[model samples]
Target chain A: MNVAALGAAELRNRLHGDGLVYRVGPYAVRLRSSIDQVLSAFSCLYADYPVEPDDGFADFHVYVHRPQNLRRWYRPQAIFEFDGKVPFKPLPFSQSYPFFEWGLNWCVSNHISNHLIIHSAVLENRGQAVVMPGNPGVGKSTLCAALMLRGWRLLTDELGMLSVDDCLFAPVPRPVSLKNNSIDLIANFAPEAVIGPRCEDTVKGTVAHVRAPADSVARAAEKATPRLVVLPQYVEGANAQLIPLSRPEAAMQIAGNTFNYSRLGLQGFATLTRMIDGCRCFEFRYSRLDDAIDTFEQLLVGGEG
Target chain B: MNSGTHRWSVLPDTVLHWYCADDETLVYYEQAGTTHLLTATSAEALRFLEYNEANIGELVAVVSQTLTLDVDGDDEFFFLMEALVEQLQKLGLIEACAH
Candidate 1:
């Protein structure tokens, strides 16, 4: 049964007790938290994800709870625990859901080294993937969310999981975190998109997460061969433009944006080289989502300049 | 010529990884963890020096033969070769061989 199948009280009981083990793409995550906001956020955003069997193994056991201290009564905060040990400082009690999301990203990026993990948003169309590597405030996630609402499937919003051997992109298909104005922009652009509760006044300004499309989550096992790598930057009032990049320039940008490029050493170098050799690379700048979407559609049809 | 006595060789103890696409090449220096983009002439120079150390005149001759540039009588070709050598040395990819 999926998380959506469970009644609200039963789901809360499972979370408060033995934790709710749920499937997230390739891994099973057991999340335990009594925070009403955390539970509510999960219910709304992750309702489509399957609930794992009671005996199944979880790749990560996570928890967000109120700590036993004076601060709980004063200015309440929530601490994130992984395998019974807290790995991060407590966040404001109001920000428990966002904290959980950030903690999960940290767990995956730090622990999973089998695939070359990149800090990028990955999307796919017709078995071809486009890897958009960018830093925060670059509108990477905003573009990713917009594409997912269009025809493209969302592979991942935060991490690009690439197979080291075949260079194929494995799908993670998690929620796309939309920050500040992008949240409202996406909501207006795709009125049907489901966005979770907004957490305001945190380090990243106001943040919200758009639920992964049901079709994308269902096809999470499928991998796409990378065909394009685009380094995207959002410039307000700028016309949407795509500039071709040489392989060497693309290599440097990919390496710079990669989360574990150096850790893989020589193997990483070989993998990145092969990936660059096989894909067309570009730098994309845009302000308008509709124009950007049109340009990408042209790209898919081999009509890009 | 005086150029014949100025020998050049790739720096010792440095592992280089290279990726070439048409006329452009990227060389990754493992020791420094840096990647340098090279033009066709510069790439040819480094590839020649990777296998054998050669003086300025010999490098120019080898690179010219590979690139089909008329360095035998072309003063401009000679000047370009010297500039490419200087560029490689500055990038720490090659060094002068002791006499």
Candidate 2:
């Protein structure tokens, strides 16, 4: 029997590239990169999502395929391809690349009503999603990696896709990228966590990815309510702290941090305003992962009372 | 050069708002957020907001005349007011009263 006969959840969707194949959740993705690049991008970046060894068809079936033509030309990003045509561009910069992570962001956002995609990381536990939104190098990935290891279910390390209808956020749990000292820090902090090999000399400094929790990966499709909207910053400080921010302030920050806020234009502004009004906003600063985790647990456990 | 009861500081350009207190003021926009406080200029700008809706051309004329400064060569006065007003508009503090 061929690999297709094995029954993969992602068979419904198919993507084709040079010689590699990708099974993005329920979709298939193909890339035109060498085996090394393909493996490095997916295997290393998202080690926790898990990939079944190929029976005899091709390399590991990937859900996301960053094309070779765009890889050299554009930023390191992921894409999700769908069976039917989409009204929006799949990649952040469609003109420069064509790749999508098989997390079904496009499908869910397209099908689900009242939910708009917000650029941030989402972690759900006990029906509550903690939204961490910020620009690059704000310690979001590091904090997310530490949270996943400590017990919070990893929703997504990037792209905190928020729903407008139910006021909930769905997890897109990709890989938690650790830069420079982060890899070592997590290794020493949580020895049990499975981390991918480190790739040296990238733009964001020497980088490696830490795997998400198995349970989170299993329930990747699940969506949770957004409780707190945090703008976390990894400052060299003595104590982890959370500072309250007003709705307008939060709105501006959330708007600034959004992936397609400007792209969404007026709709984006309205969605952002609604999101800020619905969720509590704060500025979090931390040095120790454990300290940060404790603070988050307190917030999540306390609920929005 | 003080002209009509223009409320030089009480103009419409001050329509947008962020965080304001006794001495500190914070302004937010799509581009970035800025904070202003008790400075003479900010006070004057805040006063300008009273007019409901005004642009740089009007604001420049008012400030230059009120301060008795050379209205023609002071690009700094015009430039600062224009940028601040743009940010104020972006923050929704002031809507385009023009149309």
For each candidate, how many residue pairs have backbone atoms clashing (under 3 Å)?
0, 33
Write model 1 residue lDDT over A120-232, tens digit each, in one string: 99999876799999999999999999999997999999999887988888899989999999999999999999999999999999999999999998888888888888899
Q: lDDT of each prediction vs. the true structure?
A: 0.88, 0.58
- Give the clashing pairs for model 1: none
Q: List iRMS (one decimal) for every candidate.
A: 1.7, 6.8
* Model 2 CAPRI rating: incorrect
Tens-place lDDT per residue, model 2, A81-134, is 344333333343321121333234444434433446655777877777778888
Chain A TM-scores, one per candidate? 0.97, 0.70
Q: Highest lDDT: give the candidate number.
A: 1
Where model 2 places Cα greater than 4 Å from the true spot, the runs are: A1-28, A31-33, A40-116, B1-99
Q: Alpha carbon lDDT of residue B59, candidate 2?
A: 71
